[model samples]
Target: MDDDLRERVEREAEKHALLNAVKHESDADVGAVMGPLMGDNPEFREHADAVPGLIGGVIGRVNDLEYDEKRARLEELAPEELAEIEAEDEADEHDLPDLPRADDHDEIRMRCAPNPNGPWHVGHARMPAVIGTYKQRYDGWFCVRFDDTDPETKRPDLEAYDAILEDLDYLGFEPDATFKASDRLDIYYDHARKLIDMGGAYTCSCSGEEFSELKNSGEACPHRDKDAETVLSEFEDMIGGVYDSGEMVLRIKTDIEHKNPALRDWVAFRMIDTPHPREEAEEYRCWPMLDFQSAIDDHIIGITHIIRGIDLQDSAKRQGFLYDYFGWEYPEVVHWGHVQIDAYDVKMSTSTLSELIEDGELDGWDDPRAPTLKSLRRRGIRGEAIVDAMIGLGTSTSDVDLAMSTIYANNRELIDEETDRRFLVRDGNEVPLGGSPPDEANPQLHPNHEDRGVRKIPVGDAVLLESDDLPQREERVWLKGLGCFQYTRDTLQYTGEDIEVVREGDVDVVHWAPARESVPVRMRTMEGDVTGRAEPGVAELATDEMVQFVRVGFARIDHVPSGVADDSSDDELVVYYAHP
Candidate 1:
């Protein structure tokens, strides 16, 4: 192939390779890049057989760059195409369908009852995000009720209550009111008494094993036939600590021959010797089951609609028995399937996460590796991004897998423009500079905006470049806004500020920070810690400010000690890597 033809084909190959890598958030495939290359340059067909060989080295080098570098380079080469991709992705989140029978109620109300075992994860976002959006739509009241009555199993963490409120606030799912079932035991007991008097419930002393056998056989326990007065007396005894844990239970009266064995007179309340977590509720020995307490609380709170998982359809049915017994109408219930967000590497279950925390596998609920909302927040994720991504999943009845990329795309829109561009070279190598480059240069903080005026970048002394970005001996390269330079005779010699030279040279552009303007940086990512040096301006920004590192993705400055400019503190700049 002629030199001119070879150059054109290789440039096209590099652009397509970068585009492919951006799509998958990884290296490009030869098979994929080839198709786009030929389509864009139909004249290359005559050389098709030699095309692969010609573009092989180009594709390999493009793949050799980091995801952020590929993305950044693509931004420069194909700004229009890249912006179109962003516009296309920004619209992927669907607006939720209107609520059914929205006008039938005088007022719309909803409740999210979470068991306070651990911090909320990504899966937990659906309930609050969806409800919060609905709440705003209807001007309805959203309530948060903590299911913390289970003291023995799923013990409530005292800190979790506040943490949940914080998480809710972070997600913009602020609740109109919050309640804990632990604090409402007396109310649950009052309802228990009324049910006994109404002959809708009875105290059963049969052991769990004995009752399971009877329930499965479609036979009532011996205590099932007790009169309301007798039932009330036994219920009071059970509440007054007359029975040990598992010695007795308050069973709602249902059909003895119910088709589903689990619905056959399910236990409403039980004796638990373990004290409650809250100081005010510590005196109680009898605790209500989730279904029983949540049902009663939902009605009392005047929840007009209930949103829950399809797995809890049985619980809704079980609660229906009690609703019917009290001659009360059941709230409108919306059941959705479980959500699967495979993008996050951590386990979704609170129980599992709590165990991991206990075993010292994680630092805490806010560990970057954890899927908790707090962790995402610490990692520079905006709540708007989470809500947008979650709402896009929709409340369908089939298990759905959510791509984290959707969230990243959503977050990029919110943070990319606001954040100033910075540079952080991982495993930094000091590259000698022997150029006519200025001592410092001013560049736009964001590519799309020139008015932000974040700061000017220092460009003197030595440059710290990622080892891979270092040009080989005698190789020419663009210095990104500085100028074109050639690494020859042991130095990166100035080749004048000429864009044509860079294009004609067909050399890779690399980002760098002057050693004088850069400070030691340690970025914490899910994979591991990467040590490097970033622009000192990054440390100057307030902690938690999201900064886009040129060719290095975005990161949130988690820690910036006081007097960093004077080296008065020992703490180094610590940032948490958010996404590519």
Candidate 2:
């Protein structure tokens, strides 16, 4: 470590010592002593919140010394505690409670229901990981369900479902089974019929605006007093395409006079003229609403647990009432706060992200910055990193502004160890335009990891180096991980791979390549603008190969087009996501 950094660490350690001294004092006010210590240093204060146990470590270190002696020594000079603080910080990060146990209990089945209107976002990404974490740790089973009841908002494409599956697969989420609300129309119809027979459902012929006004005014509709047989027949007619969209709706029989508007005879089924993605438009005209479908399906599917965001907490109670009305078993409810993105100061919405992608401002659903599972995966973020970040956030009943950096940092730590180093030099200009001399060149494909071993570059009388490496003034410079070199007016000599020779006059010591030898390559990164080249042979690299371009960052070989011979028009494509 640098001297300045070492001194800063030492000062922090001494503060830790002083804080410990005050804590151990007979009649000492702990906060009074530590508050000043924290107030004096921002770094110490920020880390102190996360590393509470560090105080214990500091106390232990001072055990051998007398209390007064320790205080005196601490006051004299600061001590280094960088490593200890970092270790403690890492220890507490992302350690959430174990999932609830279902061993002795049969009531632990849960399902994640996502509307298949678009691809999954980071907010939706949490569902599978959280549910999977619980299922594995608590011996629970998770089901993937599609809430596809609203045909108006639903697109007539299966690509969304396919993309959802792809996102889940990328994150290693495999549900025991998949269910769609559209598939169980009969079950919903049966429940609606039961409600009708029980006087819990009725057909409403009120116009849209009139119904809205009546609902808003907390007044019972005149149709609520209609005979059960009449309402049942009307429901059948609605189902038989006897009514057009918005002409009639099957409203549940609830207290319209009740202050709670949601329970005020809400519509349980609606007539839609639009076609369903899973079922043809001509097959049926009436469809059960979300609440109605969810209530019945949860009972029939034997779901023992309902884990969802806090926004659905009331929906759980509403569903429970339906369960009670039917005398059916209801699942236990566990609701967590919403995952709020700090950037927008609002809940993360897939629709918003999709709109951005559609407009061409964002790359796609998998754009590294898109906050989707596939985006994170393509950015080389491990699933475990996301799990750790979410679980660490803790389950609170209050909304939180989730910072994107937290996940990125978590991802960096998780991926750092697995990434093999490769040198990549961009905007290079130092090497001679002709190439490095045969004797002075010894290029290695993979550094620090020989298991992924060597990829020999064609280093003859022609080669390239990053153009930015060239300094304005002629000076001896190191080629990083390679060796040193000396530069002159417009070029630099190919010094032996290990050493350099000084040359007179100012010259740009930049990353450069032998004119036609090193093939220029392009890549698509999140932040954009990555233009580099490797030996023409790099075009032969197979797709999806993880490689590090020397002096540049690590990248995945995306594809090498066909007909691009090993020695010809090199068209190797590398994939990077905001790598610095």
Give the Cα lDDT of each candidate.
Answer: 0.82, 0.62
- Candidate 1, residue 210: lDDT: 95
Residues 1-580 of candidate 2 have per-residue lDDT tens digits of 2345335544554565554553444322333334334434534421221222333444355555666776566545543443343355667433445434445466467788888888887777677777777777666687888888877765434677778877777767788889877777777887788888988888988998898899889877988888889988998898788899989998877667767776677778999988786643337668888888888888887887677789776677566657777888676666788877553322357777767878997777776556677766765666676776777666666876677667656664444334543434454443452225453333434322345654344444434555445544456554432344556565655455432221111222222344445555666665564766654555666665555443344466666776443334354345554232
Spell out the clash pairs found in candidate 1. Answer: none
* lDDT, residue 502, model 2: 14
Best by lDDT: 1
Cα error, residue 112 of model 2, in Å, equals 1.4
lDDT of each residue in 105-212, candidate 1, tens digit only: 998999988888877888898899999998988889989999998998988988889988899999977798989888888899999999988889988989889999
Quote each prediction's TM-score.
Answer: 0.83, 0.75
